[model samples]
Target: MKARTRTNLWFQLALVLTLGTLMAWGPAVPVQAQDVVVKVGNIIPLSGPSASVGLQGKQAREMAVEEINAAGGIQSLGGAKLVMLYADSESKPEKGVAEAERLINTEKVHVLTGCWNSAVTYPVTAVAERYGIPFIVPVSVADKITEQGFKNVFRIAAKDSWWTRDQFAFLKDLQEEFGTKVSKLAFVYENGDWGKGFAEQWKKLAAEQGYEVVLDEPYPSTATDLSPVVQKIRRARPDVLMLVSNAADAILLTNTLAEYKVNLKAVITSGGGHADPSFLKAAGENARYLFDIVEWETDINKPGAQEANAKYKAKYGQNLTGEAVDAYLAMYVLADALERAGSLDPAKIREALAATNYRSGPGMIVGYDAVEFDETGQNEHASLVMVQINDLGQGLERITVWPKGARRAGYTPVFPMPAR
Candidate 1:
């Protein structure tokens, strides 16, 4: 009886030891499986004239979401992964509104981001307001976008007026460096919200800058041949030619310049045409020496830029463009805001978005360095960059950083024409 009792005691002790060891080192306690999903909605032009821009943005947003998920997602949100739902706005206002509604109502997305065109952005913003969803504008440059005073809407991109002011400053620098006077300048723009808005801002800034506007013309977006307009510009012979159009129209005008040999000292393009890679591909040698106002630069290769480039190429088999960078950074901003807000509630996200501050690609720490918004929700510290279309026609070299006296000062005219 004593031997049996001793044996039983030994077996119980060994079993207890084994169980305790298993409890200590076994399978991580299964981690209570977090919800692990943060939903984001996108509205962009997927099939219209701006399709390429929209496509780039879509790919970048997706890439950012994937990367966030791979890194275990928002650490502050219990490791919740991001899920994105995209809607095609087709560059139309009504479609944008419908898509915005669908994204908020059907998909139940926690956040909204995208809409390449400002016109599309404006309508979609109304939907976001109605649904109480937080909308972040990535590439739309319309000045009134944030000026609408929608609390839920935040813009990470610079407004048109901001770009106009920066471009004028660069022009002044160009004039001073080259001694090439731009007393009379011609502004040509397409008949869209973006074009119209830029033209008005350009006129306002030109007046303030003491430049004479020789010609201010608005053409239909679908205008195929720019020969007539080119002839008109040639007749006026403005010292500088400023073009505001998409890639296609830009190409048309460039062709006209090549065909007619319009005598202009300097040609500048709005951010829309200049920032797109397709313009270089389409215009080739004609694109050389042209200047553009750009928001993002791939060559700048600041912190997080190379990683973004490589990841973007790996996923899309192409390099990042301004459109792609904007969307990618926008996603990062959204993620940061969500994580900081600690909840997917749209209102909280809006508050957090207003408070967003993080380092993004191209060496820019967005929402940092004084990202306070005015009563109009416009980011007061927004800045712009001047980029020159180089001889290679493949990339835009940074000319200057805006608001003056930054680390990278404005450019001196490298190929300034002799004064007439």
Candidate 2:
């Protein structure tokens, strides 16, 4: 009887102490709201020859993510916050595939984006498909990337083929308005999938436009010495030069062109090195008056684009490039999908993406007429504008000169590049 009483007394004392502690603590504080985090993974060449393109894209998306979070995140999922994950592929296709796999399997990101350059995006997007992750392409424009008919892969920029027809129009305008007499046209590009498309399209267009193909050249992307190629260009004496190159090759060839003083009636380029800020900076005064077809230009006078330019300049201390503008829009596309999905299910996100008609929202910042994806997962209404670098010193400022509807006042395309 005495042992039982001692155990009962200890229990009574424990209960009394618990009550006293509760009384001292007062009313309980309500549970703090938990943040629902959505993870997005991106793989790009951050340290290779194309690193500038990747880094520029990275900064643009970071700016968008910050804006999204500041605006209270995704309201559909109780203020779900987005987290960004990035991996560098060093501009290698195999490395891009490996990094994309890591992002999907290890990091378990809900959506995947990036893998610039068509060479890298092809394999990396294939991985995203096998894992059933939604992938939005911001840079790579290889037609085959979307032609594979993968539902999970969607592209927000104009395809390579889509821009070719516009090029014909641009050329016509050049001849009629700028008095550039076109007879012989030389086509040159790096030997890769993207360059192949550029070359093929230029060949077809030149034939249709009644211009002789004087010189067609395909050089290695890693060709550091382009003096021989420049010599060939000098010998060909084409009336026009159509160069489709990435940034590094563009710099190399530009140097060669300057060295040999290879002058043509006009020079036109499709993206890559010719349309990039790094190329302009490296080429310096030589980059002036070159016609470059671009996805987006800082000087495009549009509602959302003008506003974005101001904000982008304030944030990055520089104007937004085509790659950066596309990337900025890409993040918004993912966020819009997440908000509409209302759940982390990849299938639902894909469905949301298919049904997307983000015309009036953040998707408009890139001035894409429509954000809706077609059956082939390509944006049906991606905006395209051409710009010419006007300033030739340390910094390059490319002003929109083509697509008269998008050009700003006081911006004129300098045609028939002045002889060096």
Clashes of each: 0, 2
Question: Which model scores highest in lDDT?
Answer: 2
User: Measured by C-alpha RMSD in angstroms, how accurate is candidate 1?
Assistant: 11.7
TM-score of each: 0.70, 0.70
List the global CA lDDT of all models. 0.75, 0.83
Any runs in candidate 1 off by more than 4 Å, and if so which? Answer: 1-33, 45-51, 90-95, 173-199, 214-239, 244-265, 271-287, 295-297, 359-373, 392-415, 418-420
- Model 2 over residues 274-316: C-alpha lDDT tens digits? 8665787788777777788878777686667878888888987
Off by over 4 Å in 2: 1-35, 46-51, 92-95, 161-165, 172-197, 208-241, 244-266, 271-289, 389-397, 412-420
Tens digit of lDDT per residue, candidate 1, span 34-118? 8547888889999989998889999988877787788788877788888888899999999999888888888889988879899
Candidate 2, poorest ten consecutive residues by summed lDDT? 26-35
